[model samples]
Target: MAQWFTKWIGWVRVIAFFGLLFGLIIRIGDPQPLETLRNASFDFYHQSKPRELTQLPVAIIDVDDTSIEEIGQWPWPRTRVADMVQLATAQGAVAIAFDIVFSEPDRLSPAQIAQDNPDIPPTLLSKLTALPDNDQVLADAFAKSRVIVGQTTVRTIAGNREEKREMAKVAHALIGPSPLPYLLAFPDIVQNLPALEANAAGRGIFNALPDPDGVYRRLPLVMSVQGQIRLGLTPELLRVATGGDPFAVRTNEAGLEGIVLARQLIPTAHDGTVWPYLTPSSRSRYVSAADLLKGRVPQGRLAGHLVLVGTSAIGLEDFRATPLGVAMAGVEVHAQVLENIMAKTLLVRPNYTIAIELVTTFILCTLVIIFAPSLSARLLISLSVVLLAGYVGTSYYLFVGKRVLLDPSFPVLATATAIILISTVNYLREERQRREIRSAFGQYVSPDLVDQLTQDRGTLSLGGESRELTLLFSDVRGFTAIAEEFRDDPEALTMLMNEFLTILSRAIMDQKGTIDKFMGDAVMAFWNAPLDNPDHARAACRAALKMIEDVHAFNAKRRREAARRRKARAGQKRKSAPARRKIHRIKVGIGINTGQCVVGNMGSDMRFDYTALGDPVNVASRLEGQSRYYGASIILGEATARALAETFAIMELDVVRVVGKAVPETIFALFGDETLARAPLFAALCATNSAMLQAYRDRQWDQAESQLAEVSALLDKLKLNMADYVEMYSGRIADLRIAPPPGDWDGVFASTSK
Candidate 1:
């Protein structure tokens, strides 16, 4: 009966926990983070699926760089714009839209020049004013064709903006609750010149606001200005091209359902915005304005098409960011919107999407809670991954097949959290005995050893014991310089350091070594401690070599990245290539020592840590610090080198007495594996180096100097940079030449500090 009650209470707690999580997600809906996830998911869908190949019946008349160069600069005489419009109309265009706004009167108009110079004679001024006004000439061309003039909505000024009021020509008929309260609204309107706007068939706002991330992913179909709802330029052009049909906008309590035209229904969000599916930019979608005027454009391309006149010239400053590329013309944004509408391939995130997500989260969480308690941790994790994959797959399918924007992050997150919570509960219940063991040994041993202890708790105890262990110490070189690189961004520095340390630690663990602890940018680890391995020395050596290989690969990648960045900056001519190509490489020095050491918990009574302590451990640490002095990445004590002499290519470095130690120790550096050691050049150098060391120790100064010279020449021939090793021998010889050592002198260098 007690077990039954406990199980019932456990079920209650699980349900309550999931219920609270579900409720929180529903209340918050899709916050910025969730929205960002949704956007990324949609972008993935966009990239994976083949874009619609049905060429949009729309064409953009671009004032591209070639057009601007050939036809002179922008604000080109109003007469020239009129000529392009006339040519487009002659090519049988169904409707023409001006993405360019004639907000101010033409500056070069005769009447404006006359007003600028008050000294002009009255007769001349009368003749100048009498000449046909350029604005009127453009109006005459507009009067002859089905042209939709673009306008803009602006923020409210300090005073009354009555003078800037311009009504959009499209009529809006509403059904159900009005969506104006939810629509993005502006206070004033910037319209084209009165003569030009009055003569056009229709006018609408040409506003294309980007998403929070600065990508043009959606098009606002309807916006409000000073309590008045209006259609945007593309919608207005569609309406005018369809014979000025009135649009009936459907709405419910949430906001908007869609807009109904004469022959098609366009779906939208609550605020009457539509997500556009963009394709890669195509040169075929554009016809240069100059080509249109010069009759160079193909005849059938513009016929019966809705033409949007805009510029792709870089100097125009009319570019927008898109998911597909760095920059796209703003006019192409409108063209894609119209294309999606006509193709009936519009993407929509309706008001009920949140409800659907909530249901998914609730159902998934319940399923996890029901099955998790009976399963082991491995199976539970597997089940959780499968459930997550299913949710994401379903969400992606809905997006690809149905054009629905459903967020999978919340559902997946909720399920994962539930699995974790229930799994923790199971752990607590099933591992009661192991929990007691962990409570005692967790702080002193690694998790692996702790588990082993649980299996056989007799092998481990709280006492000091001596074992043959290989201790490794690794530290970053030039860490201060690396830190200074990000002095202003400490968080970034922390992330970089953590990433590097993780890779290094992984390298060590990959060789079956146990990490004892991390000290700043350094890692201390040991082998053959908790578990007896006869090859611990070889494993430590391999781990050190692997660390060096990993750092080299990392530096190569950084250098390549830096080169690409520099090339990009150089192409822009903003700075010199050398100035932008500063690459900072991260380097590490590792040292390994093999000997018998006391491997057990050591510290104060209040707190103790599992570590290795002995002369060999101290030697390993000193060698790591000495590696930079020798200009080598890995330096191992003589014992470690002897253990791996048959496997690794080791070179003798020096015999030195480190600080606080009276005994001299021999250190060696690694070159490569056995294949490198078998090379003839390496064999010869090693033979000559050994002879040189023997001669120097025997006080044969002339012989020692001659052998050292031979070693230097061989190193130069092999293109090896072992200058530090050569410098040590040269300094020793020079000192002996000045003041020879006594006959008892040994070939050992003494170091005063670590």
Candidate 2:
């Protein structure tokens, strides 16, 4: 009845857990703002770099207050403006990008039609009037050099046009692009601009900027006009600089929606708005109109650089608000477009956003269900923080690598759920466990061990043991020598060593062993105590074999990599020193053995440790240290080899009779268990070693030597030197003949080194 009740409660918890996950998914809402923030953040990260100017040929001719005052009024004559274009080309300006629009003919200028020509000869007046307007005059100048002109789009409201043509244009340009982009006092405005767009290097539309929050953070790739999208400045500048035809722009309601750059997918959210990345310190890229008329600036400053003409003229009232604050000139915005193109730092969002959110929701609630309530709030919070940072950091990396923005909403919800669920569970479980767990385990165990004991209600105790356990020790080979030779930064060295140990631990865990702790370059761990995998000998041997296999692969990779380095060095201009690249290489040794001893917990009365206490554990540790001398990765005792015989493939190495031992014990290498029963390499290795091992065991010195030679020859012939370890055995054979074994000849090799 009790078991049935417990089962029922477990089912209820599972249902409740799933219910929470579903609820989280429903509450996640749309991640628009979060997605927007992701784009802005990634864009800001990109745009924060130093704005290095490009070498694309572009010159900005400004119509400033000085030009207005020195050259008389804002509306200059078409002929005078035409002369400026001719002058710029004469000065060797490759491209002239105008920041103004010429929609009407110049009737006020003396060179143009006279204002009083109302009664002049109809043919003569028509000739004078049709001779040229600012557009024609500019066209004449543009013919001398590459010219790109900027125009503002005006929007006109439809349906209510009869009521308010005046006020409607304001809302029209704001809501959508106006017909001004295509309007001209001519028979065909499309053909004329198409010709102009053809004559000049490129033309672009300058439009609405993202308001106050300083978001949008990147300019749109294109802007739409009357169902026809025009290229924005950066891309247009690029297209012109690279000599490509003008790209057609198409807009959706989202504004300046997207572009197909090369073969990639660059998504845009704005229909026609400019996404400006906020500069940290400086103001807009404003070049004074006064400086342009009198060449006061350096020739190369604007020479071949795509210069955007915008007003930072104070109180022009173009500024509104930004993350850094407002007072921004509208013209500086276009300069940003130039910067974005040079860096290719465009922010984009993921195509499948909902799927990402659902995954985050499911994983978060499931974790809460699995863990007990007593888990620390601090621990849960730290884990949640790691998850959030990982999510955001991954998003940032992907944004930089793929130009794809990630949904940040899932991370936010997951972080929130982690904190709430863990906090709630901890509160509930602690109350339930406090009374029941103590009463259950208190009779057999003391007050302290009760906590560490969580297997069952009346089962174990908390941390307070002093029992001795076998402490198997393993370490990488040649580390001391390697450390002595390596001259990299101390922090980097530590990180590399730590990474290697982490790899080692994973292999250890694969064998069902519990890691006690790590010390700088060494690892100390045990088995059978923490979670009680009683077949620890089998587990430890399996782990040791895995380590050896991993090492072989690592060494082969290093050899190939070293070859690459040599080749790269040969290609360098000067061979002063080799360039450093990241590579991980190392050798490892393991020692493990099993025996019956004081097997219990060991720690302070208040905080003892649970481990085994016996001389066998010490012998195993000492054997690990002996690995270097024997030219072996691991050396295990007779008992461990027997225990692992059913699963592991072993190589019988010499036994060890250390101080205080009653007799020498046989040692063997645990190559692999049933898992690697039929690997060709393993089979080949076993087949080769069997012949040489049999000869050596018979003590036929010459025969054994010949067999060893044959083995090496066969391995060399196969060209399969996976480990190439027989050479070490050959050296051992040579040594053994010189120093004939004593009468006992107990194969044990006592290790006396640290």
Candidate 3:
């Protein structure tokens, strides 16, 4: 009877504990702790899986540092601003939204200048005063183009309450509760000049109200100003772009549900706001406003693109802190919001998210309390982890799969606190055993290896077995010249090499290849080890192609920088210093081979690393060294080429016997993969090249020379440079003609060096 009573008391205590935690979390609301956790959740999601490029045709016309340098300073003449509007409209821009506010008349207008100077002649002053006003010119441009002027909702002021607004209509109340009371409200509005505002197609409030922590996460889609609902800049632009129409607000008993604009339903919180998924800032999204004004922007750039005009100059103070990065351009915020809306990838956290979180917390905490007192230490720990994992998995499922957000951290935290409180004594007693285990293994292995050992100790072994793997070796061509350029600066050399390695390594890893090691400017990697990949050969080939593409992109960027520097120097009156030595046609040679190899932990048992060894590895290295001689960026051994023949565009180079191997092997150059193979020109070249190779191998000197001549002529007509290969083949044909080969010749070339 006493035991039953004690158990009942324990159940009562558990219920009371749960109630306490629940009340605490609910009372805290969006306080510092919960806000911090929410921000952390956002950061984790953003850092782990950021949004890709949006399909929306939205762009920003940034008045950046370069634009400022060329077009003088900020608050550029209103006529100039008008010219920008005209240019965008001329280029077929559907709509133009100003992130800038034209709240006052233009000070640079001729009338304003005439009024400022009284000493001018009366006739000249009268003419200047009679000239068209700059503000009026800008207003006329706005009237001609599809434009949306910006406004700001500020704290209630004395005179602005009576001001009229073109407010949004609450079309249909789909369910019981309305969202007006929950929305952010303000009494006053900072509007544009009457001339401009009257001419614009629409108006929107550009209110960048950050969260309590000053992080701009959610953008208010609709807000109440002076008891009148208004749309945000993003939605307003869309409305203008697709015929002007008022949006309908949908609601349920919980409050706001979403906003329906035409046929599209945009999910929003109870407060009529949306959580926008941000991507990194892109220069591609921006065209210089100055460029538009000067008519220097490329044609069709503004065509069918939603252009937002704003400034990114640092002193403009139009920057906002976001999860993507701090001091991000404010214009990008609206641009991404528009992008998410159009792409239908906007993040939403409905009112029910909180209710679901509270219920989950209560259930999880109760389970932890019930299970903590009855299990062994290890089982308890495992159970706790399982519960935590389940909670997190559910949360991520909702986030990634269901496109909903549910807070798992609060519940998991509460559960952890409950378990820790209940198991403190037991945990203390077992700490010594865990410490001993750590001492035995911590010093000898990496943290990842240690984790693997703890999960399953059976994997600990010294010897390795053979596996069929795809091996890759890449080396920088003309690396000595590159080193010479950086000889005076070792730190710069180190940084450059690190960046190059990182780019190549990333290309390999992105294709799921494991890097074996870095040998100076070269890197060796393998696929289908540590993790099995059926597409290992294809992945290695793709990685080599990607590495080449990366190098080309790097060289193009450098060339642009060099051009900019040269231009800057040319404009200077003083004699400029000699231009820095530049690297042109920066190239890398990649070799790939597929065959059997030994792969596992290598080196002494006390200190070892995962690596591969065998004949295939040696051959892959040798082929990489030979890529330069073949005048190809990528070379593959026979096995790899055979595996990928139908997938990649292959050009058979030669059959060669390396120094150690007596058996000659066929090798080929990889031009491109499936995409390139589909090209008509590439296919034609491949067919012709194959015929030429056959004639050369058959010892038909006259036929081979004729085909080679045709190939060279075809290459010239196609503007393709394969001169080195053509020259090498020509020399081979000449030498063979002078000294005929033995009748038993198998057409094999012996290479004495690796």
Candidates in order, TM-scores: namely 0.76, 0.46, 0.56
| Off by more than 4 A, model 3 | 5-30, 157-178, 425-754
- Identify the runs in model 2 with alpha carbons over 4 angstroms from their true place: 1-145, 149-216, 220-232, 235-472, 555-578, 581-585, 597-601, 605-611, 659-662, 672-748
C-alpha RMSD values across all candidates = 6.6, 18.3, 12.5
Candidate 3's TM-score: 0.56
C-alpha lDDT of residue 578 in model 1: 41
- Top-lDDT candidate index: 1
> Candidate 1 — worst ten consecutive residues by lDDT sum?
573-582
TM-score winner between candidates 2 and 3? 3
Over 4 Å off, model 1: 1-148, 155-159, 171-185, 199-202, 208-218, 240-257, 260-262, 278-333, 349-394, 406-464, 480-499, 574-581, 584-587, 605-608
> Tens digit of lDDT per residue, candidate 2, span 1-754?
9999677457536655766766665546644555555445544555544234443343345555455555665566756656665555555554555555555555664334445666777777767666555556567666767666665555543343333211111011122344224221111111123334445656655545453355434455554444444555556555555455434333344343344443322445544333444344243243445555566645545555555544443324444344333344455555555555455554444335556756765675566555534356777667767767777777666655665656555556555765575566657777798779687778889867775565454323433333323346888776766676456666767876766676788888887787876766778777776565666776677677777777677678667977888776664434375556545468787877777656555665477555555777677777787666655677777777667664665666555566556577676655456755456665665666677776665556787777677666655554534233566666667888898777775444564454
Number of clashing pairs per prediction, in order: 0, 45, 0
lDDT of 1 by residue, 1-754 (tens): 9999777658646565657576665547656776676676677777677356577689999999878878987978898999998999988899999898998899878898898988999999999989988889999999999999998877875237646544644566888888888888887778898888889998878897777888887878888876788888888889989998788888888888888876677888888888887777778789999898888988778898998988888778899987664578999888888888888888878778887887787777777777677777788888778878988898888888898878877777677777777777777776896687687787888978867755875434456789999999999988998888877779978987887888898899998998999999999999997778899999998888888888888789778877778676665444333433235788888888999999887777677778888988999999988888887788989999998866787888778888878999999888778887888888898889889988988888899999999988988887767787788788888998899887777878788767
Question: Sort by lDDT, best first: what order?
Answer: 1, 3, 2
Q: State the lDDT at 83 in candidate 1.
A: 93
Q: Report clash pairs, candidate 3.
A: none
Q: What is the lDDT of residue 204 in candidate 1?
A: 71
Error of 3 at 623 (Å): 51
Q: Please provide the root mean square deviation of candidate 3 (C-alpha atoms, Å).
A: 12.5
